[model samples]
Target: MSQSSQFSLLSQRRFAPFFWTQFLGAFNDNLFKTALMVALTYDALSWTSLDPGLLNNLIPGLFILPYVVFSATAGQIADKVEKGRLARFVKLLEVAIMLVAGIGWMTHTLWLLIAAVVGMGVHSTLFGPVKYAYLPQHLKPEELVGGNGVVEMGTFVGILLGEVAGALLVSYRPVGIELVAGASLTMALIGLAASWRIPASPAPAPDLRINYNFVAESMRNLRFSAQNRTVFLSMLGNSWFWFYGALVLSQFPVYAKDYLHGDHSVFVLLLTVFSLGIGVGSLLCEKLSGRKVEIGLVPFGSIGLSLFGIDLYFASQAYTNTALVDAFALLATPGAARILVDLVLIGVFGGLFIVPLFALIQTRCDPQHVSRTIAGMNILNALFMVAAAGVAILLLGQGFSIPDMFLVTALLNAVVAVYIFSLVPEFLMRFLAWLLIHTIHRVATVDVERIPDAGPAVLVCNHVSYVDAIVIGAASPRPIRFVMDHRIFKMPLLGWIFRTAKAIPIAPAREDPFMMERAFIDIAQALHEGDLVCIFPEGKLTSTGDMNEFRGGIAKIVERSKVPVIPMALRGLWGSVFTRDPGNLFERSFSRGLRSKLALAVGMPVAPQEATPEYLYEQVRALRGEWK
Candidate 1:
């Protein structure tokens, strides 16, 4: 299947049902929670003696508690059971929980509703691992970014829709009782219906014995995650995002009311802007990433989050009145442009930050324990969110304004980003790779459109310099998993980028037969699963400017996978700084803004049967065009 067609297939039974099922689940979660919040704020006198602020803080804490406590077990269950069946059952539980929420709403029983909220939290906790792990099983690796983008977009839009609905419906008083009961039940039914369409997802490790010791097992998962230093730190980076987000989101209600002097409608509008920003950013990830797990974007996201977050503080400083302002009024303020721009950038960078991390976790983690690792990440996310609330409470108690809190959070983000990237240099490495390819050279790619947009295909390119893969990556429209020399794969800084990109490292048959065989097997599997695989068939970087004889390895890959082979060529890189050209030791030759014009020319796909060293070489040579 072509990449576009494969993506379209996901909109069919195999994927769409699961997508909407998850969407509705997220939607209903926010719906009931928002309704409860409204009920507590406007009708708190009827529920309990607790202050709304305390309850607000307590509610988020209570909801996160299950993620911390139950994710370990949930991860186990997702691994042990069929995902489709588990999804349906979870939806059924949602129905029962929503019924409880209805009962609490009708009786105005805050305690009961809070319990139901906890129940929903537990449901989400269990669903977390399955929600992510399920994607690798159903979609092609090339589809990962697009699929994840859709999921993230759906989730945020669902939350926005749910909040809007909750605000409107909770105010509804049918026969003098809040109509939250009817709304919750109806949304639950819709979610259940969606779950019914989730196609079968057979368990990967169904016979694995259940581990009832949640603490020990959770710790084990965490330790396993830590074993892969890069993956582990990425998890931390992921968790920190939640912390950053929670702190920002927690202040919105207060910011709208106190700073902007807006009522409930303003609060909703602010959330809409934030959520819509996330949706836009998430959707853009697929495009920006070139359909790969582009970790380089993570640093970009962090930078924006911090910069915009600080700007937001200044934006809010311009506000002086307690009078209510609608969306238009808020936008009309002197500093509103900065605030709006910051919020939108924060969301955009957030999409860049998160999607790659999730993809990295999926692609890099052990297939057997991927779900468990995700669960462990979820636990950390829960902890970070809880801490965010606590930090916000502490800051507010210390007489810090919400805007000041945003500034503090923004500054802290820079510190955390520096620390995390320092520990796991892959983020920095990718940033370097991204920078080198994007800035150091102005690459013009031709015949890229000849590369199939979908299905399994082999890319044969001339290996010019050490950073050939990075350059190809930046030029190509789709992610291409490169087969690299084992030594280059182990380079100090470049190795991290290769590992994150899931580059297959190969040893020559004479050096390590086992490693060579494994590399071939990995390539075959990737192609079989419908991924774009690229190879430097010349085996090593060229000593001269001429392309070497293409090796039989390309033939071996195609013979096994029967995938189309697309020939590619890189020119004008021969005399570049990284190339083996003559240059003074301390002198930089191919610096950025030197007007160096790099070119990548691709050729039409050739049938596997017709693939040969000479034929492929000629195609690539032709694509390279006239070079100086």
Candidate 2:
């Protein structure tokens, strides 16, 4: 297995089925909901309640209620059952629910249709844990970012499609209600077919007994999540995102109609822009982070969310009556560019904010307990969404315009972000670490292309600085899972970044025999599964700024796995701030550069049969342009 093939999108079976399953599910969900909402909104006079606003508010509440009520139990069920089976069952439930929705549509029964919406919410709550937990199981740690990217993209695009389909189909009065009912049924059936194809994911804990006490079990799940401070904080940050998103998005219809003076089409246009922005941002995450779960992007996302959110308020203020405007008209309006920019940036930052957090939760949580932990997070997400509605209602009651609510939410986002980052400095800390390497240092490469473009390969690099892993990470086009010393894995801020990056922590036999063995086994499994496994062969940082004796660990790994070994060298980093060399505390001259030139050189791959420490050493030193 080569490094390139390890990270290739189409090569892995772990991802594709799950991707389509979730995508179709999301698409169907939005399609049904949007169609219902549009029907209710446009034909309010024909419905029982003349107040479209009240029905709108009530619908979201009804949908979210199930998440709050059932998520904890759903988590437990997912843990105890085979995830693939569970997913199929849930999709089947979706078909049944949509059928009920179709009946309601045909009969013009709003309440029955609303019940179906609630059912879909429950379906989503149950599927939520399975959706996230399944990823860590099948995906290599290195593929987490890209896999999540695709999932996120599919989800948003599905939402956009659903919204468009719902609005358009519900408005089409061909044969009164028959056409809408038929369209809904067809989409639901297609979604079920997609779900059926999800490959078998064996249950993680088949012997686990069911916990019927929802409150107590829910509390237990939350407490279990709290045990990992970073994971818990990530959940909180994630919840905050839902809170922010719900508040902003809930007002879109109003903003479009009241402020932009457009019809439902404008509402759809706004949603399409936002959803497309998220898809683009999500896909870009893998490229930007070098295919790692880079938490640094979280703060970057937060900053953009706040800045663009504030700017959106000003843009809205500049809008005059612009009703019935198509996408082009919206673009050409006086403040249109700013509004569009803000919406797109919000989506971009939202993607940045979300993808890493999901990866962090997946990688950091106990695998056995991950599904339940996600369930707890879903519960919080439900609460936040509910709270968003409550807040919006209160603001509207106080005579605030929808645009004003957007501004308030944007400002509040800044405050919440600052508070959360202050509490859990890992987000800010990773930002610092990411900044240090990318800005002050310009890493140059010689023979980087020597690293095999595909197949399983072991990277043996001479460790020099604390950030050796990050340097290698930045240089490689593909993601590499590092096998690091356990002690370094416990480093203050650096430890969190490494863990989130899914770097496997190892110890020498003398320190922790069991952990060491597990590390080696994991390495072998990763290789057999065709993943890039990188190790600092010197085992520890070079105290004298020179390569140390290469351990036989790399040799042993290759002997067992028969993977190629790519030797790498680092230079121009011996006296940097991260290095061991003593320097003036306040007047460090080495770290002060806009882009300091650094080098990462790669040597030709040594076959498993021919690899030797002495030969690889000479190759690395030669590539480094120096000898010691």
Candidate 3:
């Protein structure tokens, strides 16, 4: 059954407890971490003589170090142990760390607080695999995107509120340290209470031998994940976001204080808008993706990230304010809102870029080894984030302003995005198809989930327009290898996309028997390898905006492959620009206007024995109805 919204999950036992646990963990971690950061930045003499600027970068770097050192073992433990029990233990550790941090607050022991930071880092590292791997066990496949979206939204909201709470609490008069410490301990206990309610998730790999040598096991985890090309690239892509985010977020305090000459509240404002932007974008993923893991958003997001990031540099450079002020006073200054907008957009786009990738990684990686794969991604994130800190430190050392780092990172983001997309053309190809459906057409799918999520299946659909494949691809949860007529498949712009999508082009036997035979061989091969291959059994687009004669090719292919054939039909696309409408291109498109409503209705899967061309033709015709 399709879930109404990602928020529906919060009401269920399976999801709510897990959500609260994760939310609280993020809140506690950031609350303490940000409180420490604010104290150091605004009250530096009491903390240490270390450059507050340098400490800002170094602190985040310190927090991620445990991800490098402990992720392998953590992944193994998560894979081998019951997740609910482990979560409780992790939360218990948080409580202990908070106890230590409470002492740091009361005694004014900077070293103790710093150690608590590292301890909290260890807590997060252990929880990382459990957090992601837990969802796949609980949620349905269709719910993965929405589930992930809600989790991300909750996490960032937690981080945002925590940062805000921490910033506000630490700066309180008379007993600021006491307030911060008390709140941290209280949150840690609440998180532990939440953990007890999490439903039990059995280990996928109970026999996984725990490896104590973190370094060797970490390499093994990386090597294992590297075996899957797409998954590995996605891991790298996921890590790159962290690199970009760390670079941006780490600079906010200094940027607020030194550049904008603003008080701590100004720093809180930056964190507020940016995290809120991410929360909004993350929740939108479910709606934008039609509840599927739509990775096309990755490219779309990267474009915005670079555009706004570049603008952020210019926005800051344009600001002339130098008087020290709080957030409200800073808002009154010229050019400040632009900086806020840029940061918000950057966060929004970052959400768009990341949430789908997380869903993709979860859905794509080996089921029994999800934790380890996540560990591999975490390792990459740690390395990249550490690199972000090092690079920022180097830039600042070389006399680069905070805005200079923004410009450099923004430009580098563009380069990195292009490089990753080039390596995986699927990202770019899906983006084009997604753009078409979202901008020009609004698509609804009927009984589409009847198509199997895995294994071999033959998709036979009526060809209604030139973009039938693109439309179908846009609606599908999985990539479909479309088999198109050689002529239409070779059209200029469409041809480029077809090639990138690895669409197979076939000619009629009368024209080129060799190509026809080769196409069948390719179809059989794809099915044998367990892929979804969609073919237009109508053999050609209907000239009258109706179903064409059923070609015998579908029967022959089904007989050979012995796989279920899903009969589908496109409706309400007959007079669209790509169709054989009785009008010029401009006229046909103008008639359709924007966001034209179209539907792809899929019927029950026909067994190989029952899937004759005639039977399948009637099935598709029935599904399409007279909408065309």
User: Where in model 3 is the C-alpha error above 4 Å?
Assistant: 1-3
- TM-score, candidate 1, is 0.79
lDDT of 1 by residue, 1-628 (tens): 5647324755477789988888888888888887777667657787777876667666777888899889888998998899989988898999999888878777767788989989999989989999999998987777888888888888888988887677667766654235667777787899889887787888878998888888888898899899988789999999999999888876765577667776666677777878888888888877766666778778888888898888888877875656667777877766666777777778777777888888888877888887888999998999999998899888878989889999999999999999998777657766766677666777677766777756789999888888888888776545678899999866787787888678999999999999999999999999988889999999988777788888899888887888889888898888677777566534547343465678788888899999988899888888876672
- Candidate 1: lDDT of 347? 79
Clashes in model 3: which pairs? none
Tell me the whole-model lDDT of each prediction, alpha carbons only. Answer: 0.82, 0.80, 0.93
Q: Look at candidate 1 and give me any clashing residue pairs.
A: 2-454, 3-454
Over 4 Å off, model 2: 1-13, 174-177, 322-324, 440-569, 573-628
Highest TM-score model number: 3
Writing each residue's lDDT as its tens digit, candidate 3 over 331-406 gives: 8899999999999999899999999999999998999999999988898999999999999999999999999999
| TM-score head-to-head 2 vs 3, winner | 3
TM-score of each: 0.79, 0.77, 0.98
Predictions ranked by TM-score, top down?
Answer: 3, 1, 2
Question: Residue 350 CA error for candidate 1 (Å)?
Answer: 1.0
Clashing pairs in 2: 1-455, 1-456, 2-454, 2-455, 2-456, 3-455
